[model samples]
Target: MGKGGESIPDEEWERFLREAEAGVEGAPEEPSARARMVARRLREESGRPEPWRGHPPARRQRGKGWYAFGLLVAAALLVVALDPGLVAGWFGGGGGDGGSAPLAVESKRPDQPPPTEAAARRPTVGQPFRGSPAAQWGDGTAGIGLPEARATGWMDKGQVAQALEKSRDFLVASSLDPGVLRGERPRKAIALINPHQRDVQDYLATAFRAPSRENDPVLLFSRFDRTKVRLVGDVVKTRGRITYREGKRGAVEVTTDVTYVYPAVRAAAGSDEVVRTIVRREVVMSWDDPAKVITEPGTFSLVSYKADTTNGGCATPTGYFTPEFGPERAASHPADGAEVDPYDRSKSMETRMREAGGAGCGTATRS
Candidate 1:
């Protein structure tokens, strides 16, 4: 008993909508039994003869209430099939402002599958590290930056070489004292070390303490001396031997011995001082078993460093008068094929040093 003569209840209207929406394109074409009965009653009430002669009509005539109910059901279903939003609004499912939200019909592309956990966890290898080029650079050299080595497949001798190359490049870039002062060099370089090694952590911590309290000079210079030095422009040669040691509890130790031919030069009082140094480092990496790769941090940490230098490698330079001073004796000299005077100047220091037959200042010693 709504504004209309007789209105369908809210519950019945909702049911009609659900049914219509479920089978909008598959509704039966013929009228329902109730509808047919109602039609017969209308014909009988109007005093029209039945289509079937002689005997009474096949279906009993329905009351006006049944007729009204059947017509209402058909009308509600038709309206729902035509416009679901209007029915939803009529059932109080619309917004408070007398509007209804559109039906959210889901559609997915046929070829694309849903994402999975494994796909999300795929390793990012062979991809370049994207960051500020300056942040990646070692010792301010253009194009020389942090390592691009990511965890790919299993670790092998070749992969170890790539990691060693990153360390060596860091060293070459750190020849300038200014690069060491940047502080990022140590942080980035330490990323290679396994964080589980307390000894390595202690060593790095001791080396990078207060400005005057640090010990490891070869790794980080104790003082920022104006000694313009650069590694000689020669192919860095490396000889490594990989050793695997098995232990109890399924732990395996993978060790490597790497020897590097490091030639370098430092400016000393208008003369190019050649310093030939060879570094033999031992790296101990850990793996789960024979088949597993050691991808943990500090697995490739440097456990031992033995640097042999030809000149001024062990002692600090002595100043005659002011702070700006060089070594007393120019004794350490470069190897035969190494470059002595690579820096551009009016006169080449290499010529003068070569004529002098090996010029070096102090005895080269290990740090």
Candidate 2:
């Protein structure tokens, strides 16, 4: 005899206890769906009003098995009520699958400040790149490390290696060289390009001598106006990757995707505020096989170039980048396109270019 005038045979009760004990000892870390459902049902039934409560006792005497069963149900319900996370874990709501786990109620505290606020609070006088992600990046040309070169269908391993080395040199000259950054001609970089590509050379000359909105040298090289801003430190933080693949006409095409972070302050004596300009560039250079393609023997030809500059004035018609210091300065050259996260390099340059449409000013989500 059990509660509510229910009767359970002694043999069935003994079998139930044996099975329950085995389940308790051999259960997996995470409960299965059936186990969760059973636990949930037990919890719900324990909460319901008992029909036999306060009624006259049944004719049959209650057995010890009934009390044991009641105790097991009470214990399970207590555990489920006390630790909600236990229930969540049973239903895949916990962080068992590499997701963030639910924090205990007692462990939670007040929210901290936002990332922007924390960044703004950091000092910049002696630590120009302190709060920036570029702080951990490589300095100058060291970041432009080449990948392992292998022989492709178009070129031998030695040729591929030379082409990669030349591509690295071009990257260092165009982006990391101090003279190039200060609006000087990237002579070394230009010399590496194929001389037969007269149009590119002509464009570079025009871009340097007289820059216009159409032929801005900043598109290919990273430069800043020396008259307005001075570099904070000798080190320019840089990081990115270089890759090569076989192209049409038996040419080995090397592609460089690099980002440079330059920290600067106004040249004026009183200005101690440090501002950073981030430039991300993707350039494609091709080494043409002399027999298969009509190109310079040792030099590479520039196929395409694209760049995105963050913290630069929007649509400024100068060869050098004009860094925006604050809201007052940014207001003068208002950005007009989608917000960009300059530090995020997960997407390719082509994808970003497509998202950006043609050349127009875009707001930087951060510096």
Candidate 3:
């Protein structure tokens, strides 16, 4: 019936017949387990085959209908070749899929794990890798423009000094500030409370150096790394008592409530750490207990502050600012606001000028 001896590919004939037959039922879900297993086995086997050493034998025709359809398509193609414009018009203007519009192609990137650790190491703690020095400065500074200074009249030096004095004098106050300290208990109480923490002794021994002999010779304390402090020889033994208080801003701060005794070099210009020892070290730790809705004083409000853990503690991190402005303070002072006095032209006067401008702020020039 077809006018040709050649047969069509089985797939093409099968698809053509399927479409031509029409009125087919939708595929069923939950295919039998046997069929599912067989399909999977077929898909796996499809990956490899025996190599053909020579020209393979031609495939045999399983049905005569394929040969007829093949001849019809061959004739149609020959006609289309002679009149491409006419074929295009009939098929809505394209070669692909009889001009039924090409399928929209989509490309998807393969699944990848989130770059969390890498991001953590970025220019700042927020990024993947260690950030550039400039980025670290900018981010750690909490977006405070460099050349920053305390805003005009923000913190009066006199007032700040008075407040600090009061803080220092709190120990002398006969009565403690009640309703201020939470989970407040003596050091002995902690051991009684958590008797299971075997490491508490180690923590105390290392964190707070207890006096060994009654009269270890006095040694000056100096700037030293905590890790290297244990190696110091001719150590100074001192007696001290520390107390913990939940800071007004939701932080657990250990303070030297009373230094019953402590060591110091008798030197006129004392550098305390000739053989430094930690007597009353304050560990500013976080209080993970549920926060309280404390109504701060009208003048100085209670605030919550998180330690600067980002950027390897090189700079401050989140939750350190006042509520209105936020928790960050600048690292340097800018001189824009504080003009130079004509009288002080000396190079040694530069530090004084910066100190005069602001207590703590950094600034950057506008680009």
Candidate 4:
């Protein structure tokens, strides 16, 4: 009786219905910011517009027709009781054909029409449908955090397409949100570096065989010897990826795993020489500020002994040392007692080399 169960007065129902019949498409009103964002995110992830992506809000616009109809039905029932003879005769079809005529025989309530299947499927008399765009996109929007998104109401088909376009360029590096554990957010973003084997080999050759170390004198037979030098043979590779949110803050997080085929090398150890142990490392780098944020030497960690032993040739978060960084050291010396560099070999390796060479008499060599 009331068109769409709206609160329109009886007189207004006729006008609105007439307008609808005249081919006017009803539109949903605009929604609030929170509602809009929710709807937007929903549509973006789903790849389709929700039924209420951007339509008018709910409010009473039809009331008179329903009220009048309810009164009419009540009046009809009252008339039946007031005149039992006419009412009973009318209902008692076998009594006579006069009251049992076709119109009277097929009598039904006149206040409202029967409900249809489509009408039943619609939102209840007072509620609105909150359509989800997710119902459409599925895995296509695999990286989206479903609960974090927002969208508007009364959306049309084109709105879904717009959401997809907006979502494509997003890159989330680190997901620090605790909500994931509580089922609040979905899909954490991860960055990856897929380096080829050949690429790794090239980097290793450059880093190991480029003859970059400074020339220094070593100790032999309790004297400083020029021929004694650090011998190193390494085959290494590197790659980068974004690991977490900070990575996405200004750069892409990358995981560069290096598997080296290191060869034996001899280094001066006071009166003797020895090859260093093989090494392995896991390096994490960021893409945006690649050079500025990671493994640059003394600043960002060049290598992290994250899951491997230090003797495994693993690098730590040490800054890169260039020729201009500092002066070269005099190799291990017997007089220095600890095969440590006479100039500046007090570092871990330098101290170890000196001690192993049996030259270190326990004198502390400050690097």
Candidate 5:
């Protein structure tokens, strides 16, 4: 039986063992660049603290099947080394022309886990979204659906609609834009903010110019280190709502509470493993009635901004998000708070943030 208790044909297993043994025997004395990269990744995944020596560790007596299985694993890695495209195909290549079989998108409640073991497996080249809550989510801007706008106590229906549209634009620019995701300055998002709000302007300027733990740019933008990782696909799964209500002093406050899921893999050529980072941002922007208050004619002033990041490492201090690839990475960057489920959007952002213990890292129940 296979790991998941599925029956494996005797002939197929024997064929695999024979091929793996042959590959191992024919491997070159010096590992190729691809092989080295794969080896490094495996080592990292293994969570070993010791450095690798030139020679393999002393082997102990074990069943022949176990020994052969080890060889099979090594041979599989060798196959990956020989064909870099195999890795790309496993994680949904940019062109989608790879010949790997894609997994069906599983149907489940947004807060529920994968229904079957097969559905819970790590995503393959053809099924990059498998095992994720985001598999069924709408892509990018399409997911940020706007609510029906109506006249507030102070603002007209047109003005309310404008405010909602502007809020949506800011969410796209800050969270879903490819340029912003690749760590570029969010110029378009910044442009939407009211300049008359000096405090917000100053805060943003400081965050961009000299980011620190207190003034991290990630609080406003979803960014990653381009040098370290690249997005798996063009799609960024998003789900959230935009709401507007009457605020103090005759202003219309628009609040966007959205969660963004990003799938990424190491930037290296042969690296194929995909890891996801979840960011939930709640931003409040208000437009004051022109007759009641002096403000930027069309721009909205920042009222409040809060974000909760999951599967991003605890010690991430570079402003760019650090994706935790596996349990080893999570162990290395142990969070201080309780495990929070990133996929559960039932609770309000404020409640989730409160549960996460504000500004501190918390382990995600699942990616």
Candidate 6:
């Protein structure tokens, strides 16, 4: 047995037996980690620890003395088997049952205890766990695709957190950039999106297209018209954490609790009408890439997204967006024609909000 499975000391063994026979206090809480291992080994070696039911009726009269002697012999054999040094001492060897002397077993063995959770979760180069004190990326800062992240290790828990952060930044920038919204810089902002995140792509596309019906959600923001509303103040501030787990088939599911804040406007009307909208969004990012390494701009996709408009008078929707989990709606506006749903079979931002609003979601009015 390994050092961790070392035999219990004679005094501890006796005390344990005494307490166990008394039926008052149970065995001492496995003393230490190594002692816990020893306890497990004892169970394996001595069979079950159930009380002896005397040898059938044949040995019913075997005196208590014989029973006690039998137990002592069994304990001695267990000690000799677990610690050869104790057997050596029985024959006048210096090292015996003395607590001061070390066990005759080797201190180190080829098989050591299993890796601890912390050791298993230690972050790799380039992929530092977010805010982890133990993480040490070559550069003070660690980010996706940075030179330091080019390590050979697999992704850790921290990488998932970083990926969510990167994903959020990409989504916000793409939504705010007029060039990307209009077809001018289409692929530029979406470079970080996982290829499989088709629903996310469709969602962004339909959000900026021309409005089809009354209270068109896109109209609330100049319909991606930079001349109408200019993005001002700081970018969206995210306040939330992501929860992730290894999924079936080796996939990873990351749930994000995010709140987004941005200034929307009615610039074309010649009025400085800007409303700060705070949206609480819950979405899932699922990755199914076979690539060896996933960097900041790697293959991670937005599996699903649901956003609720919290700011009242914002004129945006307040319900679910993805058709897979919610309703269905569309639009068609060909450049000059005004009303255009960014994609087919998807709900408008307002439409989603309306659905959620019907469900009793809270509302926040603009100041």
- Model 3 / residue 251 / CA error / Å: 29
- For candidate 6, the 10 contiguous residues with the lowest summed lDDT are 320-329
**What's the C-alpha lDDT at position 140 in model 3?**
14
Report how far off residue 266 is in candidate 5 (Å). 1.0
Highest lDDT scorer: 5
Write down the TM-score of every candidate: 0.32, 0.65, 0.14, 0.17, 0.67, 0.36
Candidate of highest TM-score? 5
Higher TM-score: candidate 3 or 6? 6
lDDT of 5 by residue, 108-178 (tens): 22454323222244665556665665665667767666878899958788878888888889998999899
lDDT of each: 0.37, 0.72, 0.27, 0.27, 0.74, 0.40
Sort by TM-score, top down from the best: 5, 2, 6, 1, 4, 3
Give per-residue CA lDDT, model 6, range 75-159, as digits (tens).
9999867765436545643221121232221112213311112212222122212112111111111211211122112355566
Candidate that beats the other on lDDT, 3 or 5, i.e. the better one: 5
lDDT of 1 at 351: 39
**Which should have the higher lDDT, number 4 or number 5?**
5
Q: Please provide, for model 1 over 18-125, each residue's C-alpha lDDT reduced to its tens digit, 9 standing for 90 to 100.
A: 666687676545544443665677676856655431475335454666788999999999987776544654664532122323222212111331111111111111
Q: What is the lDDT of residue 180 in candidate 3?
A: 13
- The reply for model 2, stretches above 4 Å from the true place, is 1-123, 330-335
Summed over model 4, clashes come to 67
How many clashes show up in model 2? Answer: 0
- Lowest-scoring 10 consecutive residues by lDDT in candidate 3? 304-313
TM-score of candidate 3 against the unseen true structure: 0.14
CA error at residue 300 for candidate 1, angstroms: 4.9
Q: lDDT score, residue 288, model 2?
A: 86
